[model samples]
Every structure is written in C-alpha cells, then in structure tokens.
Target: MDSANIVVVSGLLIGLVYGSVGLLSGFCLLSSLRGFWAEGDGRLVRSYALAIGVAVAMTQLLAAGGFVDIGKSIYLQSSFSAPVMFFGGLLFGYGMVLSNGCGSRALVLLGRGNLRSFVVVVVLAIFAQMTLKGLIAPSRIAMVGASQTTTTANSVPALLAGAGLSATAARMLAASIISAALIIFAFAHQAFRRSPGQIAAGLVIGLLVAAGWFASGYLGADDFNPVPVTSLTFIAPIADALQYVMLSTGSTLNFGIVTVFGVFAGSLATALLTGRFQLEGFQSPRHMLRSGGGAALMGAGGVMAFGCSIGQGLTGFSTLALASLIAFAGILVGTAAGLRGALRVRPLAAA
Candidate 1:
C-alpha cells in the first residue's frame, strides 16, 4: 500500500487491537486505581505498571536501533508547560473517578454492554473537540501559551546530555536505568506472573505504543508530504473525530481521529458478535448529569494535559519525555485525591 493507505491501515489495525484488548481485559487507569483503592486489588495496577515499563523499553530500543526517532513525537517538544500538563492530568484523573472509567476504558466497557460508558465517550469526544479547537479552545490556548516554557532538554537523552554525557551514551544510560527499574517492578511479583490476561494487557498495550511509533515513523514517513509523528493519544483525537464527522469536506482524517473511530467500531462489532451487546442507560437523572459532567472534565482536562490515560500513559510516556512524567505524576495524585475523598467533592468511594 502507499504511504497514505499505510497510515490508515496501520491506524485501523491498531485501533482494532486496542478495542479487542480493552474489551477482553477491561484495561483502564480509572478502573485500575479504583480497584486498588476501593477493592484492595493490585493486579490491574501492576498490569498498568508493566505496560509503562514495556513501552519505555521498546520505544527506547526502537529509537536506539534507528527504526524510529522518539524525538519526533509531541512529548519532546521544546515548549514545556509543566503546569498545564500537571493540571490537565489532575483533571483527567479526577474526572475518570467520577465517570468511573477513563476514555479508552469507557470504549471497552461500552463494548461489554455498559451504556453508561457510551455517554462518557460521547461527552469526552465532544468536549475534547471543544478543548482542542472548539469554542473553549481560545481560553485553553491562552492558558497554555502564557504558561509555556521552552527547554532544550525535553527528552531523557537531552537531560542526560546536559549532565555531561554524550548523546549516544546518555540515551543508552537513560534507557537502561529506567527500563531495568520498570522491569524489576513489573516482574517481581508471582501474582503478576500468574495472571496471563493482565500480563498480556500490559505487553500488548506497550507493543501498540511501539507500533504507533513504527507506523508514524516508518509506514507514515513520506518525504514528499509527511505527517506529524504521533502515537495512540486519545484526548485531542476525541475532539478531532467529531470535527471530522462534520467537516470531512474541508479537513483531513488523521491517525488519531481514525483510530478513535476504529476502536469504537471494532468494539461494537466484537460486542455484537460475542452476544454481549445490550442497550443500557442511566438509572436516574442524577447519574446522567454526573456522566455528562465527568465527560466535560475529561475533555477539558485531556486537552490541557495533552492526552488521556492511554494518550499520556502509554504513547507520551513511551517517548521518555519529561512532560509525560509530570503528567503521569499529576494523574496519580488526582486519582488518589478523588478516590480518597481528599478533594472537596465526595470521593469515588463516597459516591
């Protein structure tokens, strides 16, 4: 296939995998954190950790092998707005708790016949667009623009280089140290090793991260008319997908938007075939209102944060970008606050 076809096909396939995996594994950061906090379960949390580690190792390896350049991804941009990313992550984390799932996870749950997630996804997509280029985009743009901080050492390699290491040596050292730590944490538990589905979720998700890089870096690479290199981020795509639906005449379909659609379609297909499809709705008006509110927060926060859990958690983190780390930390804190009732509002547990 030609480069354009390659990008489209690759995006579709990636979305299919995400949908299938999400359907089967119930993979999601919101659920994982909830399970850990509310149910005293660490399996899903470890699974998520494994995914992050694998993403880091494989993505770094891909860069080291010259198969792709991690620097090309958005995470490593010279413009660094740490506060925006941090607050964005915080919003996404807290929103996920209120919604009871993150964006990608919501898609997966919807496939399993959860109508609640359907509302969440729709809200997320719509608000995400608003955050990206919709009516509220101006405020977001101004916020980020005013807070943006330019930095040469955006990536791990650059940071290491600043510490007096050569470029190649810095890259290798950073990769080894981080990967080793992640691997040890992920594999140290016998419980983790025993759960094949959870482990597979982590592994497959991580591979998909690398796959995104390869797709953009290799398959989508076109000197004549190259697209910006990116991976499986969800926030902006949720918005972009909505825009594409209305403006396909004047706009181009990007990998993120296409992949977002593909995941939903793939999940719907799977749900239908597996006899799991069911029409579901809210139990009360209160629930519907909460779902909508949660989705709005997701969209707005996701835009500020530059991604959702899957977007920043996997794709952004894969690049070993410093901003991704900040975002991740913020997500953790926000999730904790929401789950623990630390926020002014009722916590997830109380709700």
Candidate 2:
C-alpha cells in the first residue's frame, strides 16, 4: 500500500497493543497517582515512570539513528505558549480526577461496556472539537497569541547545544540523563520491581510510543503526501475520530483516527476474552453531571495543551521539549491538588 495506508495500519497495530496492555494492567496516569497518594501504593506510578523512561530512550534512538525526525512533531514546535499549555494541563489533570480517568482510560473502559465512559468519551470529543475549531477556538487562539513565544532552543538538547555543547553531545547527554533518572525512579521501588505485569506494561507501552513515531515519521514520509509525525496522543485524535464517524463520506482516514478505533477494538476483544465485559452506568445524576463536566474540561484543556496526559506526558516528553516539561509539571500539580488539599475529590458516600 501507499505511505498513508502503511502509517494507518501501523497506528492500528500500535493502538491495539496499547489497548490490550492498558486493559490488562490498568496503565493510567490518573490511576497511578491516585493509587500512590491516596492508597499508598507506588507500584502503578512506578510503571508510568518506567514507561516514560523507555519512551524517551527509544524515541531518541530513532531520532539519532536517522529513523525518524521527531522534531517535525508538534512537541518540538518553535513557537508555543508556555502559560497556556501549563494552564491547559492543569485543567486536564483536574478533569481526570473528576471523571475518574483520562481520555485513553475512558476509551478502554468503554470497550468493557461502561456506559458512563461512553458519555465521558462523547462529551470530551465534543468539547475538544469545539476548542479546536468551534466556539472555543477564537478564545483559545487569543490566549495563545498573547503569550506564545518563539525560540530556537525549544528542547533540552537544543538548550544544551546553545550552552556550548555539540549537537550530538547535547542530545546524548539530555536523553541519557532524563531516561536514566526516570528508569532509576521506577525501579527504586521494590514493589514495582516485583510486579512483573506492571513492568511488562511499561515496556510495551513505551515501545509503542516509539513505534508510533516510526510509523508516521518514516513509513508515512511520502514525497508528495507526507503525514504528520506524531505518536500515541488521544485528545485531538478522539475529536477527529468523532468527526470522521459523522463525516466519513467527505473525510479521509489518518493515523490518529484509525488508532482510536484500534484501541477500542483491541480493548473490546480483550474484555470479551477475559469475561470482563460488563454493562455499567452512572450511579446518579450528580455522577453523570460531574463526569460530563470533567469530559468537557479535558476536551478544551487538551486542545489548549496540545495533548492529553499521554499526549504531553509521554509522547511530548520523549522529545525533551521545554514546553512538555512545563505542561507535565502543571498536570502533576493539578493532580496533586485534586488528590489532596481543599480541592480534593472526597469519596462519595454510599447511596
């Protein structure tokens, strides 16, 4: 097939792996943090850290080996609004708490017949599209335009290079330091090390992120029709997938859209095989309202942030971009606020 087709197929396979791993191991940032801070279980969070470390190492290897030019991805853009991205991440993080999950998690849950997640996914998609191209677009654009700045040194490696390190040396130093630190943090926890399933999840998910880059950057690099080089991100892709469902006659298939479908399918197949598929719904109107509101927040915030948790946290971070760091910090802070402090989401009393 052509380059576009190749990339689309690759996205499907990657998404399938992600969905299976996610369902089996429950790999999610929100869940990880909740488990760590609330329940005092650090294993899940360690898995997430390991995933990030692996993604950074593998993605950088691809870039260094000339297999992919990740600089072409959105994370490495020359111009971006740090303030806006941070605020957006903060909103998304909080929303994840309210909804009890992030976009990717919701998709996995939906595959298992959680009707509540169906509402979350639909509302998130609608609000994301609005922020991207509907009513919220103008306001988002204004916010970005007011604070966005252009910089040649948008990444850690580039910053090091600016500080007198050679390009190759800078890249190596930055990637090694960051990846090693994350991997160390992950394995530092004995509980996490013992959880073979979580470890496998981390390794697989991390490799999938790099695979996404390779699929889009290398396989889809057509002379006449190049595709955007991106990895596993959910926000805009979810929005695009919703639109494609509505406008398939006029729309064309792309990597992100297909990946979305593949994730759902993969999770569904796994759920059925494991006898885990069960119908579920909101407990009360209050629950539905909170879930819907959270979805809306995620949609809009993800648009402003240019990614969701996985989008910015892992995929963007792999690029070692300064903006990703800022956004990631914002997300962590927001998550902490929701998990603790006065803003903490108290557990619902039994009905």
The CA lDDT at 51 in model 2 is 94
Candidate 1 has a TM-score of 0.94
TM-score versus the correct structure, for each prediction: 0.94, 0.99
Candidate 1 lDDT over 262-314, as tens digits, reads 78877888888888788877877777777778788888898888888888888
Q: CA shift at 252, candidate 1, in angstroms?
A: 3.1
Clashing pairs in 1: 129-239
Number of colliding residue pairs in model 2: 0
Residue 99 of model 2, lDDT score = 94
* Root-mean-square deviation (CA) per prediction: 2.2, 0.8
List the global CA lDDT of all models.
Answer: 0.82, 0.93
Worst 10 residues of 2 by lDDT: 342-351
The worst-scoring run of ten residues by lDDT in candidate 1 lies at 342-351
Steric overlap count per candidate: 1, 0
